[model samples]
Target chain A: MKAVLEIFQNVHMALYAIVFILSLIKYPVYKNTSLKFLPLIFLLTLVAESMGMFINKVYESPNSVIYNIYYFFYFTFFFYLFMKVINVKKYKNYIKIGIVIFWLFYLRDLFFTDIFNESFIESYIVGAGLLIYCIILYYISILQSSKVLVIKNDLLFWISVGLFLFYIGYLPIKIIRSWFYKENSFFWILLIIQFSLVIVMYLCFLTGFLWMKKKS
Target chain B: MDEKEIIIIAAIAIPISLVIIVIVLFSVFARRKNRMLQEQEEAKKVFDRELAESQIEIREETLRNISWELHDNIGQLMTLAKIQAQMAQEKPEMMTEVSETIGTGIDELRALSKLINPEALKSLSLKEAVSLEIERFNRLKFIEAKLTINGSVMPIEANTQIILFRILQEFFSNTIKHSKASTLKVVLNYSEEELSITAEDNGVGFDKSDDFLGIGLKNMKTRAQLINSTLRIDSEEGKGTALTLKYKFV
Candidate 1:
């Protein structure tokens, strides 16, 4: 069982490395301003994720400060990367507001959670916020699909659906973990589901990226 | 990373890598295909341009044919009528009737020749040509027309003068045929930077929201485009219509 889990982790790392490398080469070809920002954000997230994974392996408890810092950076970079890819003008102000709110929430959680009396539900609250944010991004992506002239309808639909499924995948990991305190079995299964979702999201973006060239 | 991690990562990595590769291939293929399509579009545009030029040539040929017919056939008939009127004066009884008939025929022939080609415009600039047109319009029974030249005549290409004359004729015919108008004003303004013309009439205007494509108006627009001029129109229902043309110097 350990061997199986280790194999999955290696595969994930290898995939990330290749994706990171290819995106670096592909960045120059995308002249669109929004798309041009994507590869840099992805590279930043990739490095953060790599460092987080290493920290996760070295530490036994979830209380490692280095692990938490890497984790924060990882999620932040991922959010920024997703924001770069979605081409919608209406959400411009909304994204700024969301980042401010998220930053406030993050700072509040960091300062208030351990020093003051805090509940175990704090992590779950963060997860819920992230889930809600992803839902809004998915909605924005759907709305923007019409305005983005270069993307095909079907591919846009798939990307929106992938985002929705990713949000859904987070729910089981967030709600069930806090409420039920299930065994490690649930954790592994949730991770696998989330990994599957990442694959789906990548595929949808790949489709959208390829569809752009034919649009004009 | 250990063997267990390797296997699990392969499970996720394989599919993702495959999707990425497929996407790259599709992008390359689509770019090549779009290049071919762009070439085809360029070829089609060239073909259409050639076709449009041919059509314009055909129209010019038709106009040339009508011009010769007026100059040759109608001009000869007018000369014969004038000679017959002079011969009728030799007798007293039939001279009045024949002379009157010949005089009316000569006037109709002269008008027909002017419609075919405004030869009076050949020696004049655009402003002078427009003034000649206004003088002819005033001679008609029912037209209350005015011509105004606001500035000194600028030197213009003779070809441009011909195009402007045809455009003015089209406007007059449109007012006569469609616009139930009593007064028409033709204004010409010349400056170093641009040449401008304004033709306005108090008329029963039609609804403009609906697509109204008049052939004469379309021809005038094409002529304007050929000379890099802008044409603008302002009209209201039951009010009036104004046409303006401004030519860019550079």
Candidate 2:
């Protein structure tokens, strides 16, 4: 079981690296599309993840600040995409408010609250919830659009599916870690589950970059 | 309340929730696929309906044009030939002119007979179809109609051609019947990825409100949609009216 857990842990970041490399190779396919900057975000995540590991190991300090900033940008990128893709006026307004709320929370969590000591769990939770809501709204918009006919070939749909699945699976894990990590006895199992979700999420991203050549 | 109890609860609950999420996602995917199939079926039906209607409309318009030519132009030629033949009884040179008039009337009647054949009309390509309409307009002196085609003519699907021709036909009818313009212009530009058709008439254009959307114009809009093309109709009161349809080849 420990060996299995170790394998999951080691595979998580490697999967992200594979997706990052694939996103580069497929850059021209989506260069003129709304997903043009999506590869850049993947590059940013891989760099941040490496930097986080380096800081935690070399400095013997918490690496929460790096991830806090990374999550902030991640949430912002998805919100920007949702704003562009989603058409419903009511949902658009909700996404705008989500952006504002995420920004305000990140500012408060970073400057006013603990920054380097612990990860920004509360703000991250808020960001995740809003992103999930935005994705659902985007799905609803796609249902009403002619785009649904070509959903399989659509890059945005694949990316949204990846985001939706990973976030929904990881949200509970995050809650348990933040609220009950100190007292939790099944922490290893949850960590392994979290790592598995990361691997699946990266695989989803790789699938999108590899096969999504149809213009969205 | 104990740490061990909380851990046990979470382990069981998390996987259960994940299973539910997976089921829900599967259902959503299934529903989206069904909706997409329905949409494709709906589009196909609309295209077939529009094609049949446009074919009928073209036949009716051809009959109208043939009737007008037979009564007004060809009929006038026959009457003139009869008077010229009577005059020829007195002058030998007038006989040659009377024969020439009779020959022209025979050619006009032959052209009308070809139009009366459904097979000949069905075989016309999109360009040929539009050319025939322009020729009829100029021959009838309805307006000084001009068709300017730029770039090599790319082959469009027959179904798509029907919709495109009908849209331009609607625009031409409106120009001749209501515009009171002396001239009408049409351009078919074939680009690398798309075919653009533009028509304009210098006339008393109508207001840009929904009130100006007649059934003919609305039908044109829907037909363009059926073919996955864009139809834009722009007009300024008293200035002129212009229509542009862009159809990208798949």
Candidate 3:
């Protein structure tokens, strides 16, 4: 079971390398906008995910604050980039509101309750929130398509779907936690699924960047 | 909070924030770059237009200088030859030959000089110039050109005369070059309101309505624009062409 997890992890790592190289080549050519930024965000996310694996296994790194920092940057950049591409200038106030709400929820999780001790519930809630935001982002992406004055493509759609699926995939780990608790095999399966999803999302983002640059 | 809960929360928060920040910065940068490109394109267009205007101005200046040189130098030489030939009329045979030869030579020189210079257009008047041009054209065997002036010649400014003469020459040159027409007609008319010149050729006509511009036509249009005159060409492939030039003579 560990071997299978290791294989999946290796594949994810290889995919991450491929995506990083593709993105580095892409960003210089593309230069600006949501499309260019998406790839860099993907690269950073991949790095964070790898670092996360290292800390989990070897360092037992004190829940490295750096991991949380990376995650914070990743989500904010992704959401804002998507919004800019869509040019939801009117909905900008909504974004500020959303950010505030997110911060509120985050602080509530960190300081207020023993709720974080409930691993299943905590995973489920976090996954669900991201899932909801992903859905909102997808809807924004759709609304953006209608009156686009600039580059358009199906790649963003695919990336959004990858994110949605990863969110859905995350739900199972929470739902079946009782059955898989303290089971290294189950944890391995969950990690493989999640990491595979990360690879898929990165590829999708890379594809989007390429399409935009080619059009330009 | 337990490790699992903390990790889960962090995962969601971190990725989202990072992506948004990068995108905003990138967008601002892109917009700045795009603006620079647009400004560069505008500058190029302005430069190109200025170059074209300068070229046209230089050509007009050269033509004016050549016209003045022909009249002042060549005209004087022809006059002197005619006077010297008249004095040599003492011997009967020599007088006839010299007189006839000198007269023909004088006519030829005047014609050549007219070809070189559009002539003192203001002194000749538009009507007289049209008459002279038609007479010249009538002498050619293959094509017949007719002129009609309907109103008394109005005194126009010297600058306007030179500009107008060049425009007429440009039109006639095009007709001779492109139109294998048998007949050409020019009409100069004035009313209480405006002065108008219409030249029509029953030669190979061109469709002037086309959006695509030919160089000759573009040159004609530019000349018309320079003088603030309205010029129109009506033509078809085989039918013929009629060009009208009109301006308010204030």
Candidate 4:
């Protein structure tokens, strides 16, 4: 069970690294502003994950604060990514407002409410907010577009799907982590599920980067 | 079930349900988008077919006009020139008159040649084409036809010009054949953004309500819509028929 968990974590981290490297190659060719930030975000995630893993190994304590800081970067990067891709002007403002609200609640929880706890409150808020943005992206793309002729080849479509699957699939688990993490079997099952979702999400991102050509 | 088990089951159930919902929504949107594309392609096909049909109709109409002009006007003029030539042999002084008569026939044939040349007609601007039609009317002594240009002329797209010409041809055909009009007037008004054409005839016009669908009005309206032009027809029992067409420059 420990081996399987370790393998899953390793694969998840490797996928993140691959996506980051792929973004670096794609950045120059595409010259897309949204893609320019992806590599930096991925690198930040890797560093944060490594720090959390090292802290846990040496001190034998859950590195909640490392992830708490990572979540802040996660929310910030995705917020910027969503703001760039969202087509409607009104929806862009809405996403900006939503991000502001999420940050306010996240900062309040981190500093004042639960300073030392691994509550996953910020994850829940960021997850729910990102889920809504992903759904809205899909909705607006479908509504405003005359033809989603090759949706699989569409970068925005794939990106939204990846974000939607990862956030929504993991949202319930994040919400109930406090209760569920105590059960060893359930905890492993949830981790496996989360890992699977992460793998699928990264595969989607990879496909978008490799196969989806710049729209002329 | 314990609270823990219930929580586990609910957690599994909710995400699965959400995944199902997302899949369903995506499929529905894909289907709708495909349907819309199909409808757009069908509409384009119909428009192309109609445009081709209108082109053929216009060519046939022009051919019929050329045949009529040759038989009625040119044939009679040539016969007169032949008679004059026979008399000019005896009276050398009349040779100049005979030559003048033949020259007139040649000029008429030359004018008719412009109508027969498909390439010339295709390259002809809307203003030039309309002016030629007016000139033909005057030359034939059919009616007191007059063409008035209001503003500086602008070039129109080729396809749009063809459609507009066909619509105007239909109107002129109706006016000459049905309406016992003595005078016909055409006004071409060019504005900054649009071109407006008004054709009016002093004819014995019918009731507008009754003759709304008379002749090729419906076809004209359809062609106008195809070119994104607005067409208006006004007539009463005794009032002359007036057709106003406004086409915006795109």
Candidate 5:
């Protein structure tokens, strides 16, 4: 059972790498749009994951610091990109406010939390909530635009879906993880679910790379 | 709650929420996609209906033209020939006059038949169709009309041709019946990317804000939009009316 779980985890990690490669392959297609630098983010994520893995498993050191920095850049770029893509003036302003709110959370982590040793849970939760709001705004903008009819071919639409699904599903698990980590069976189950979420998220990214096209 | 029970609830609840989220996302997009497709289907139906109506109107107008020609033009020629034949029975010199009149009538009949033939009409390109209309205007002395082709002719989509033909037909009809224009000009400039058409008439134009031509012009604009193009109309009182349409090659 442990071996099967390990395999699932490895497969999920491999999926991220495959999705990263696909992003590189398809980078030129979306290089002109706001996603011009999207491939770099995937590359950043892959590196972050690999480094975190090495630190935690090989060096037996905490990986939270790597992820803390990774999350900051990832969420910041997405917030900025989503703001660019959103069409409404009011919602764009709201996203600006959200960015300020996200900044406050980052400031809190920098000032109060032990970012090098522990997960930035407070800011992660706050940022994830803001990210969800940003995704909602993105959805609203998609509805307003003619892109609604042809979102299947939209690369950013798929990525947004992947992020929205992962954050939303992982929200409860992140909250409940510390309370239940002492229970081995529960931790294993959480690990499996988390691995599945990663696979699902990367699968969406792969689909976007394969099928994505500019608005016709 | 005890720790063990809370763990149990959290484990069960996490998967359930994920499943619910997936279901909601699935249903939302599916519903949106279905609605979009339905709108497309509806637009297609409306276009088909408009196309059918325009075709019927064109046929009716053609039949009206034929009736007028047969009664006023061809029928008169035949009567003149008959009168000349009776006089030729008296003088034999009138025989040539009767033959000439009969020949003119026969030529007119042939032209009308070509106009009436569905196959000929179906095979007519937009350029040819507009040229024929221009020729008819000049032949009937309705107005001094000319059609100029600038670039090499290109094949337009069949449905697009029909819709464009109807728009121009409406313009020509208005010029003849309402514009009281002395000169009507149509220019078709075809390029690799698009076909730019401008049809103008030097006539008593209307107010820019006039709703008198609103319904007709609105209908024309709607049809243009249906074909993913816009019909730009420029007119002024004591000036002329010019309609410009730029249709991209599909």
Candidate 6:
């Protein structure tokens, strides 16, 4: 069980690298201006996850600091991508305001609340923000677009669904992590669920990258 | 299981279920939206095809009118001028009548030239086009036609004007061929947001149940719908026929 769980964790990192490589291959073919940063996002995720793993496993060090740094990078790239895809001029101001508020809370948590450890509150805040963004993306994809005749093949639609499912699936685990830590059986079960959700999310990304057509 | 474990299990189950539900809902919603958009595109394509067909029909109808006018009106006028010219050579006092006949033929040729030019047909406004039709009717002595403009004239889309003119042309053709109408009146009312046109003929109109209003009326209604306009036709036995069209500017 331990060996399988370790393989699952490593596979998640490998999936990120695969996604990055796929984006690189697709970069020259798909000429969407909004998708220029796709490979960059996957590259950042791969580096962040590998570094976090190295610091925890090989160096025997706390990796919360790496995660703290990575969370900022992840949110920034995703926020920009969503803003570009949503393409609503009026909502840009609201997104800017949301980013400001999220950073203020994140910085406060980094300095004061859990300076040396992981801050579940900060993770929860970012998760909630991303969940709302995904919902808004879905709303715009459905209501604002009449030209897209095949929504199933739409890249943004799949990305939004992946984000929505992952956040919703992981949010409960994040909230109840402390309780699960003291219960061995519950911890394993929740771990399995969390890993499964991550796998599904990465699969959704792969599907989106593979199925998306070149913008005309 | 303890209470915390059960609560955790329920919490996990609820969100997973919610995720599944949302994904399914999005798929259904997207399919519905896509189908609606496709239907709209199909409708627009049909409208475009119909509009193109109507334009061709208008051109053909104009050509047919030109052919008849050349053979009947202009041909007869030229023959009369030739006869008068020959007479003037024999009798000097007949020169004035010969010159008058030639001048009248020149005027008829000028009017026919305007109708023959495709650019002129496309460039003319609804009012100008209707005026030309009325002038043709009066010159041919087919009917007494009058056109009245009620309000300030507003520029309309050229394609829309052509379609409307063609519809009125069809009505005039039917009135002259079947109605035995002596008088025809057309009114154009241009309001701030809407343009209204009414054409009424004092002739022997058929009953509402008559099959005479078949393809012609359907074509007119379809053309009006293509321009987002409304058309109404009223007729009764022995009463005159009236056609009203109201179009709103977006």
> Which of 2 and 6 is ahead in lDDT?
2
Q: In candidate 5, what are the lDDT values of residues A74-170, reduced to their tens digit?
A: 9999999999989899999999999999889998998898989988887888888899999998987776666777888889988998898888878
Model 3 per-residue lDDT tens digits across residues B3-49: 46644654564455435634663474356546656765876565456
Q: Rank the candidates by DockQ, best first.
A: 5, 2, 4, 6, 1, 3
Docking quality band of candidate 5, CAPRI definitions: acceptable
Interface RMSD of 5: 2.2
Which 10 residues in a row give candidate 4 chain B its minimum summed lDDT? Answer: B206-215
Error of 3 at B213 (Å): 38
Instruction: Please report the TM-score between candidate 4 and the true structure.
Output: 0.71
What is the DockQ (computed on Cα atoms) for candidate 2? 0.35
How much of the true A–B contact set does each candidate keep? Answer: 0.00, 0.43, 0.00, 0.20, 0.50, 0.10
Question: Native-vs-model 6 lDDT?
Answer: 0.78
Candidate DockQ values, in order, are 0.04, 0.35, 0.02, 0.22, 0.41, 0.13
| Candidate 2 wrongly placed segments (more than 4 Å) | A1-4, A54-60, A87-93, B90-93, B106-161, B164-250
Candidate order by TM-score, decreasing, is 5, 2, 4, 6, 1, 3
Tens digit of per-residue lDDT, candidate 2, span B50-141:
89998888778777778888999899999999999999999979999999999999998888788677888777888898988898889878
lDDT per residue (tens digit) for residues A98-174 in model 3: 55655556556556444323332442345356544744654555443432234235445546655655555555544
- The TM-score values for the models, in the order shown, are 0.49, 0.75, 0.40, 0.71, 0.76, 0.64
RMSD of each: 11.5, 5.3, 17.3, 5.6, 4.8, 8.9
Model 5: residues with Cα > 4 Å off, grouped in runs: A1-11, A18-43, A76-127, A141-158, A172-196, A203-216, B1-14, B76-106, B148-154, B189-197, B204-222, B232-250
Which stretches of candidate 3 lie above 4 Å from their native place? A60-66, A112-155, A172-180, A184-192, A214-216, B1-250
For candidate 2, the per-residue lDDT at B194 reads 92
Docking class of 1: incorrect
Where does the lowest 10-residue lDDT sum fall in candidate 5 chain B?
B2-11
Model 5 TM-score, 2 decimals: 0.76
Looking at candidate 1 chain B, the ten consecutive residues that score lowest on lDDT are: B2-11
Pairs that clash in candidate 4: none
Q: Of the candidates numbered 1 and 4, which has the greater TM-score value? A: 4
Better structure of 3 and 4 per TM-score: 4
lDDT for A54 in candidate 1 is 72
